[model samples]
Target: MDHNINTKTEEETITSTSIHQESKLLGSNKSSYKQILAIGGGKGGVGKTLVTANFAITLARAGAKVTLVDLDLGGANLHTCLGVEMSSRTLSDVFSSDIENIEDLCAPTIVPNLQLISGAHDSLNAANLPHAQKQKLIQRLQQLKSDYVILDLGAGTSFNTLDFFIAADVGILVVLPEPTSIENAYRFIKSAFYRKLKNIEHQLDARELVDKIVEKKEELGIKTPADLLSAIENESSDLGGKVRLAMNEMNLKLVVNQTRTGTDAEIGFGVKNVCKKYFGINVDYLGNLEYDSAVWQSVRRRKPLAVEFPTNPLVATMQKMVGHIVAEQAEKIKNEKSYE
Candidate 1:
């Protein structure tokens, strides 16, 4: 944590136009795409990176080409989670001009069709990456050659993390059954929703209105996405339509991890219902990873649960979730084709 790393570079003006147009990158333009799944949570120790590593390994084991990009700039240990030591080349190398293209930084792993771009343990400033660098990374990531590119993001509501999550093909928020995890998950959702709203359109008028809604603080203030939508409608029906459409397109998903029991398993449904009620967005609960003492054994062995304990219940759950994701992507392709 050096002072230079935090404020070394002057903060540049980053407009939201690029992110606002990211969702339009459907297979309509390209026949196929390397699906980018960004995993994040508002708080640490909720198993976000572990989930990213195992899920990426699960996809690779299923024969899908996968590139796991460890974007946890603060604490980069995803390589260790996969039992792979830190690569000689990492994000720092790319920043230092040692590597020209990030695609070249891929370090081969034991699993077939799987590669990893390790985060730099030495680049403390990388956590506060400049806006230009952030955009560059996001664009280069889209060009990666793989069926799935999983971005293992750091835990927090920082705009850097949210921008990565928001610009991805799919954003998965990992939550534990614990109360603190649930609260952080909700905060993450709200922060992400507002970040997206700020870029719903380039028009100063619409952004100004969104700013007003976000700035409200009262007993019945704009406390939810639905509330913001109502305010937009009061201002102008046309803008409200645009805002609602933007909110719907987010399609934020949830994954309940480390559920300890049957009762804990029921938390996903409750969280989904509450999100829909307050956020005015339907949150799809992708699946959950049951609390397994053996998960630590797998970790101690320095291997992913999906790799070391393929038959574990959590691995089975990962398999089911992977199938669902694959099917959903296929359907999106099919529907895009029909329109064409």
Candidate 2:
């Protein structure tokens, strides 16, 4: 099972073949290589689902085909946020053989060019999916034929959550301005970085070194991934170079939600700078989402923020964030093509 995009050589080939077969099923003649985006958090109630739902709507309204997946498993509620009724065949059905492919489980959303894959109506232990099952689902997600496939992940640094976050081409970590939220976000990112390194430990030939640094981080003066990398370089510069290259390739976007004051809004920048200094990771602050009564109102009304309160100021900020994300993705694709 490939845990992260950086080490998906085998999974990539399998995904490509699966995607080609799925393209014919979906009647998509253009292409089936959809960009995977995962919205995650360190804790629940950070508005991760809210941001994901609205982001999907904004992208679809902009004429991009979008699929919003509720991967929260047993705690799924993304459908409620999007005002979409759960399909009879949820993601759980895919595992049970009731639904052969995930694409067949897609249910139409109110927003045109948008589809919903609800995670509701699952078994008791849906969240604790087996390793093989999780890998299969990830591969099927890659086979989705759309411009973007957005996953609303469950909270915490659980292996399931971290794996899905790492699998995505783009990961957006949502956090509140509160101290607890910020701390949880840091833990989430740190755990993810460690998990990514562990995934490629064999190639780096530093499994023992990484394990030692993590297990006795304080004793070894390894406070962060950057510290661990420096220690590794001290041991073997060649191995350290490889680790540095991998860490540099990791890209994440941050969003501070429910900000009420100017100070709250600045939290995103602080977190971004801290990540670079401590973890040696590039975190793009995609701006903050202010506190708005309309958010809860929309929830009460069982509709998306854009639909329930189109004139809300928060909606405008979300639109700008979505625009920026789309522009960045376009630039990245262009650069990759140029290099090719």
Candidate 3:
């Protein structure tokens, strides 16, 4: 569960075994791994599902095999957004041992090249599982054979939500222009930062320092992760360097949703700069999605917005965000190859 790409020693074995088995399943070499795109927000009704459904459709249309997962363990409605009925075997099947593997629960959506993995019902206690079950699920997710796996995470910074978000190759934090949403978004990032620091390279001393900083936020007037980092560096520069490297390795992206005015559109950039200055973390502002009535109309009809209104402005924004992600992933793969 190390936050940076190096992962934990145990995780290295998991990856090697996963690639070996899954690559044989797909009859392909382990030359590339599937891209995982996850969308999470601090609160509900912030368009996390909407963005996820359309984003998956866009990538699938580009001929990439994609799977949209409803990781909203408490409340799973991604099926509703995709206009697909519930599968006979949902995540509950896996939780109940009715299904041996999560991939067995895969069901097709209306869109070609895309599949859906329905969420587990809260009644099944899928949201808060024993540690063994959670680890098994995480490993299974790594072996999913798809070009992309889009996870629509539930709201808030719950441990389950935060772990899935952290596991994603491209984790997106969505927020609205409203004050409540913005505040929650900031909280979400802060919680994620602490969680990440707590796990990175198993540095307990640095993690303890982070805990103290967070606990003293009110008294010390620390508003950003960067401010907290400065305090740690003042205590010990060596620990601060490790923290900096860990934070820099994380690629937490942001998107402002349901924006109406020009001011609303610019809010993402503002938040990005603030995070950079105070958090000492670089946030990629993938741009904002403007408010469009057609979005609701499509959701009402239970069709993806991209399918219903391909020419909508919001769709264009989704396209641009996808393009950025593809480019970023390509660059990342290229660098990995160069190092190899």
Candidate with maximal TM-score: 2
lDDT of 3 at 311: 64
When sorted by TM-score, best at the front, the candidate numbers are: 2, 1, 3
Per-residue lDDT over 193-292 for candidate 3, one digit per residue giving the tens place of the 0 to 100 score = 8778777737545656666767878888777678877777776788887787777666878899988899998999999999999788889999888888
Count of backbone clashes for each model? 0, 0, 0
Provide C-alpha RMSD values for all models, in order. Answer: 10.5, 8.8, 8.9
lDDT of 2 by residue, 193-225 (tens): 988888768776789876766787787788767
Off by over 4 Å in 3: 1-32, 122-124, 201-223, 231-239
lDDT of all the models against the reference? 0.75, 0.79, 0.77
lDDT value for model 1:
0.75
Identify the leading candidate in terms of lDDT: 2
| TM-score for each predicted model, relative to the true structure | 0.85, 0.86, 0.84
Candidate 3 has an lDDT of: 0.77
The collision pairs in model 1 are: none
Candidate 2 stretches with Cα past 4 Å from truth are 1-30, 203-220, 236-238
